[model samples]
Target: MLNLSRLSTSLTKHGAHKIALLIRDHDPDKVLSLLWGKVPGINIEEVQARKNLSAGTTGLTVPSVWKEAKARGSETINALVLIAIIFSHHTLIAAMRQGAKSDFTGRITRDVELDGKAYTNFAHTLEELGYSTKHTQQYVDFDLQRLFKIPDLNSLALTLLALKMKTAGWDGTGDLKQLLIDNGFHEVFATDEDQFEAWLSSGKLTAPSFEDADYFLDAAKDSAPAGKYKFKAGHKTKQTGSVSVKSPLTKKTAQLLHNYIQNKFDEQLVAIHGRDCVGCEVATGLGTSIDVVVETAKLRWFYEIKVGKTLKACIRQAIPQLLEYAYWSAEPVKVDRLVIVAVHKLDKQSETYLQKLRDDFKLPLYYEQFVDA
Candidate 1:
């Protein structure tokens, strides 16, 4: 027996009044009637969505909230705001199960009651307003996790959104950071601009596991910054050897080989694509950085620069690291190629293994050997 009045009051308390008014103004009377039916004793209408632009031949201008969201380059924020307003309940399982049709609907139905008809109507209105089912689900999931006191959802959502924007050629870091702070994710995401960009690029922020969710809650309860909170870092490779002293000549040779190969690759990229190619040291989800990454109009190349005495040694280290980088990316396309840039060519055995991986696993992997003049 949920009190609809208390839920409505909670919505108003959480700065959802403007969005609520927007729904009342634009949506039909039947929709309003359905919403009011939930509360059982409220009868008032004639609220309007806020208008932003000057009136034109196109009709009344879009609302400022949506306009601002569009200006920021993500209409998803607009949809999420509306969702936060209309389905302003403490938990979303009920609303989503009854009102939404998404990948989660089946799962939600099995776990929660199917009585939130009002939410279904609201979800339909959101679709009419041009939000996709996936985006709608993301918003619902975000707010639901927030209500459940999960602290990591904010970072996870922003990170994924940033990735989507970046793949579309938009830098959404600034807008997303501000949004996170505004939505009470300041503690976990109060990182400086550079660090925030690194986090998004690395794809370290992901959907939280049960343990991760609980850890975030603990951090929030303790009022500790996310930086100070330590969770178990993933992708730790098994160490094969101990740190041993190396001769000065050996170390120098390795450094020179690495530098030479990297320079040659850069020159080759510039020659092939000129200004269209961009290269950088991209951070990885494993708390490490890729040696080099080159992006062109058609392909993204991930390089592992290594200079060991034998090709086997270089390939052994590069394979695992490159694989981690490829799978950890949040981009729509996986890494186009996994390349081992080494000082010497692969031997028979190394080449045989590489061929097997390509033929059997369909891994787009190769080795590029460089020679210094």
Candidate 2:
């Protein structure tokens, strides 16, 4: 597998300033022409080779080169956009190499579709700069996907922006937002700006997060007609069953049973060990919060509390969660036991599975079922 961290580091080492210089030095028309394969004499591979040579030989980094560019009154927005384009090409190369040995066909196909649309829209914007519709459409249909073999330009721009934010903290000055808008990414920033900003602030811009965001944007666009599209800047709401909750009795019963079982466990632990068991909800840093963590004198117990109609149902719901909690905890070895606490005893099949996990897999995991008073 391609280590994304190493790839990101390699991209950063390539120096965004040198990329900006390459864009600033060339005419926008020629740059677009080179990108679209209009310039027969200059191809992307030759341009990339030259860029690698310049980046390696020059001692200048992104910050220093950016400073020099600013001194010379270079347009920062254009530079950022052009750098994003270059980064997208490099990312496609890396992704293709990695996908060659694995099953990334579905992901690659989705990226190509979404990014193809974004690239087409971008080409529409470039029409003002002298690209005809025929030429732009031809480039989008033939050269863009065929040559780069990745997603569209807009997502590439977003990914580059996210990488920048990850490496260099956002200043909240709206410069990055403006840069995106100026370069045909108005859809991302058009609506729900505050929500998008909050998401960015949460520091959860993993590869999956970017993919989720892209999926959301694409879905929203598909649901709306052209020129009337409204892009929401967050995840899609999860669909839930339409089961009726006629009364609050079920909820209250579950809550009371949960408390009773927790108290019983605490009392039992204290009576046996002569020390109070500390119960707390712990954040596991893996996008999940452990429901109840009980730390006693000699052992740390990770518990997934569930109140289902049957013990088997509860155990089924809690098994993966309990295992994940135990594995992703700050100190997994310190967690001596993983327990699934429910309101009833497990069925035979559930018991067998738990035993197999404990005996065969040597997992320190088990189930604890408690009766409701």
Runs in model 1 deviating more than 4 A are 1-249, 329-333
Model 1, span 1-373: residue lDDT tens: 1232322212112222234333333432222333333444433321212111111123333334333333333234444344433333423323443443322122222124222543343444444444423333323221222211223333434443343234334445456554433433222222323233323334332222222233334433323222211112112222223222231113344454455556666666556656345353555544445666767557777777776545776687678767756763444236778899876666888889999999999888899876443
Whole-model lDDT values for every prediction: 0.43, 0.42
Best by lDDT: 1
- TM-scores of the models, in the order given: 0.32, 0.31
Tens-digit lDDT string for candidate 2 (176-244): 644443333222222223223323333221121221233324433222222211111111122223322
- For model 2, the stretches where C-alpha displacement exceeds 4 angstroms are 1-249, 282-289, 329-333
lDDT of candidate model 2 versus the reference: 0.42
